[model samples]
Target chain A: MSTPKKILVHVDGTERSITAAQYAICLASFYHADLTALYVINTRAMEDLLKARIFLKDEQMEYEHDMEADAERYLNYVDELAVKKGLSITKKSSRGSVHKEIIDLVKADDIDLLVIGELSRIRSRRDEFYDEAERAMRTVPCSVLVVKDEDKVWEMYESLV
Target chain B: MSLIDLVVEDIVKIPMTSNDKPDVLRELVQTLKDAGQIDDFDAVLQAVQEREDKLSTGLENGIAVPHGKTAAVTRLKLAIGIAPNGIDFDAMDKNPSKLFFLLVAPPDQSGPHVEALAEIAKLGQSRAFCKALVNADDAKEVVDLMKGE
Candidate 1:
């Protein structure tokens, strides 16, 4: 705690992720903390699909490229939002199990705080089991903030801009 | 960007005549230029060479991706060459490389290029896939294989 010096946000291309990013940017400005946003490409799942032959080799490659593009698009949008508030934030993307990547970076970088969007609504035990963001929240060893009340967070973001 | 969207018969050379590394690189880059995927052959070649000089793109499993980013292409472009005979490209696995993927792009457009590189790496994991591509008889066949046909 001691006023988190490094803040990490996990973006997964969801509407809630954007809300989380905006909230993180606002908080970074407030506390002068270093903010870094990360997106993991879920190569683990892609490999599983390949193993099942659900995706052909070429299809798996193409799908990975598309996912990478998605990651870049989301990261760039978060960067633009941070820039609008005159804050320079770090953006990073990795390819692996989403939750594992988040946990790894949190441990490696000694992230003081981790911010994430609202957890996906769990439809079943398996759904909760597979939700990477929810898994990341449970696994990362740091203060976790789950941004909700999208309208209120959006208003705060607009005020900063 | 889907790797298949950039995949085409015009840019693929099967049973490549080139027997060596430099020639294979030249042949693949030339394929891109011939297909109008790149305009400045010299710049594209140099960029690829510079990248190769720094580190070999030769990966294991008979795959080699020689790539670079430059103003030669407006977007990410790919050219593939299959050398059944294999050539020494200083591969990490120390084996000759048979599949060559030449990629060029605008300097600022790195996302697609990196994605393409990762795609090739992922594709290398499948021996069956690599074998199918290597055994392809013609450019159309190669394109079809890459298109996942």
Candidate 2:
């Protein structure tokens, strides 16, 4: 309800996540709020590899290193966008459940508002529609804004020329 | 890159006349050609259409960002179109898309293209900003809103 003082955007490699980061930057600029972009590496996926013994010991280490690099790369891209706008943003990365990390970060940073993209990869399952977003929305302490691209009236003008 | 800087003034159509996606894209692609942003309008259109064929750029709420990486543009080019009545864009949310951000860039210029796309995506999230853009009656008003003036 009140002007947000601290805003966090969940950033991943997806286009939708990039949209969320952009929305967060705008909201942070308008409200003069501190902005942070958080990227989680999905440690659970790595754990699955461990359980399956897919990679040998040395290979596992290499895989983890590559994944870490990817996380930093994504975070840096977000940082670049913030810098271009003449605004500074904090970039954070974690390794664990995506929604849990976000929820924890919200509490740890005293985040007042959380911005996220509306759609994510759909899984082929009985409850295909429910995704991490549903969980994050239900549990996060701060106000959550799921940024969705909307149709505006202005896009319709046809060129007479 | 600032979305405002990339906006071709002559092409920022408000209440864009085309109701369907392909025509709207054609109109915008022509805008780029008229502004001299792209050399071959048909190539750029094909590229953008190809991108869309992969997946609908129709994002939820009301925005569609149709983009392509092609040789037609030497640098990054952006055109904004708004349709007050909304058109069926086959968006992920299945809602009619009213605001369009047409991004065209050379295949090598992924950096600028991504930056501008991110900037537009962020700007699109603001209900207040979108409202102001919708109420804007002319190109100047639209440009001013993007400039954050």
Candidate 3:
């Protein structure tokens, strides 16, 4: 029954991310806690270039730029959703490994709880690149909520509306 | 509500090659036709394009659910295609999509169409699902993985 202060929600502009955002917003509203939505850009394109994939260099740059722009557009949507729900929310974007950035933010912001979608790539029980959230859960000094893919929240929404 | 609502068969290709969005989409639609899932390829493509013009179905995690509810389709169906190399989809993430869940629902079933899109979005958000999709070698594997097997 400790008071909640700040909560961080990781969003990757995926539908699962949106659902996670929706749930986070609800939690923020209930606790009157500040919500921060984050999007992480994968640096694998740069890694691909370093691997000597010469033909992909230009395409890789274009892809990176597009991803940044797309992240901005999606953050705008999250911002709007926060406004509509009367939740105090801020959105931030970063580049690099998703788990590292998320962990850094948790410590820097002193986050009370971290919420993210539990899916295939990010839910690795083991593995460096894929099981980012699981890795963070073990190391970070905060509670983690991995939203299930088949959670009944949407079903409830559909039924209520 | 038969499980085989969509007959992808040999039409599903992995590591599909396409320089851009239109070409990839056209190829996927043609695959559906070749698999005998749809009667008219051109009409279905047009419908999908027109829908894209209105709103992108890219939900996240390098995934795009480019769907069309068209009269060209007699039944509700879905076709999944994986582009391991990723295709430019003008998605919100600007990441070329390695996974696509192309849905073709009857124009009349608006509710299910939206539901399907949401469901696909939910599936894409799961990092595990996206990883499996990127690694899947063929259509049957893709279908089986999507069905949670």
Candidate 4:
């Protein structure tokens, strides 16, 4: 395919997600693509937890606030990584269903590529039905890249110089 | 690094004597210098003041995490001071801040610094935890409470 004009990476503070961000940065730098990093605070999960009585109303609020902090932390880390490579990246965060937020950004931003970490292990049929990242990859109009092999990716990132 | 690991007994002060924001900040930074955690006190203070000038680090719920990035410290150093009487730290909620967590780190160590801030935000969610820390009698008690002991 033609060089991607825009790329969006999803980060969630996970090691694999970080590796995915690094891979996307490398790709963006090589292709001179505009990069956007997004962190979706899984409010749907929190709501589900509340519904299941696992979280009380106050607990939900506190957890959401904490999640917001987590989002900023992850996005700032991505910014640092991009700066190290002399690339400026746009950082966006949302509070809602993770996949819905991602797909909406993909459509609105006209992103050419959506890079994500290895689809979280699908342990059950229910997971396949409910996984946000998996659903986003399947539905987004853009091409998707599932980054894996953390060691290789880390090595590649370190070799960027 | 975890908050427990970073905020040891040496830097934890209960019933902090400072009744105002700048004084509290001064006491915490001085505590770190006295503990030999950082040299070039002026450089570290300048870094923190610059960051504070941009925006108050005083979060809601009686918690203020005043952090800075500077070369004066090679690694992350944390100092906690509790003033049960409360000090106005320009918190978003407009409530007096009772817990002060001062973080100083090298510029290259942004990752840990951000993590520490996020951790503080999460911990602030627990009102009980903050209360316990403030009501504690001594620095060792403050450290124990932070350690979840």
* Candidate 3 displacement at residue A142 in angstroms: 1.5
Candidate with top TM-score is 1
What candidate 1 gets wrong by more than 4 Å, as runs, is A1-161
State fnat for each of the candidate structures.
0.00, 0.00, 0.00, 0.00
Shift of residue A33 alpha carbon in model 4, Å? 0.2
* Residues A120-154 of candidate 3: C-alpha lDDT, one tens digit per residue: 44221222222444556677789988776535755
For all candidates, state DockQ relative to the true structure.
0.02, 0.02, 0.05, 0.02
The per-prediction i-RMS, to one decimal, reads 12.3, 16.1, 13.6, 13.2
Candidate 1 per-residue C-alpha lDDT over B9-121 given as tens digits, one digit per residue, 9 for 90 to 100? 89888888887778888898889878888778889999888878766778777788777667766778889899988888888789999988777766544444544555666
Q: What's the residue-level lDDT of A134 in candidate 3?
A: 50
Report the TM-score of chain B alone for all candidates. 0.95, 0.94, 0.87, 0.95
Off by over 4 Å in 2: A1-161
Residue-by-residue lDDT tens digits, candidate 1, A19-69: 999999999999999999998887776676455333357646766776788
For model 3 chain A, the run of ten residues with the poorest summed lDDT: A121-130
lDDT of 2 by residue, B68-147 (tens): 77887777788888887788888878888888889887654443344455556556668777777777888877776665
DockQ-derived CAPRI band for the predicted complex in model 3: incorrect
Q: Give the lowest summed-lDDT range of ten residues in model 2 chain B.
A: B107-116
Please state the Cα-based DockQ of model 2 relative to the true two-chain complex: 0.02
Q: What C-alpha lDDT, on a 0 to 100 scale, does residue B93 get in candidate 4?
A: 81
Q: How do the candidates rank by lDDT, highest first?
A: 1, 4, 2, 3
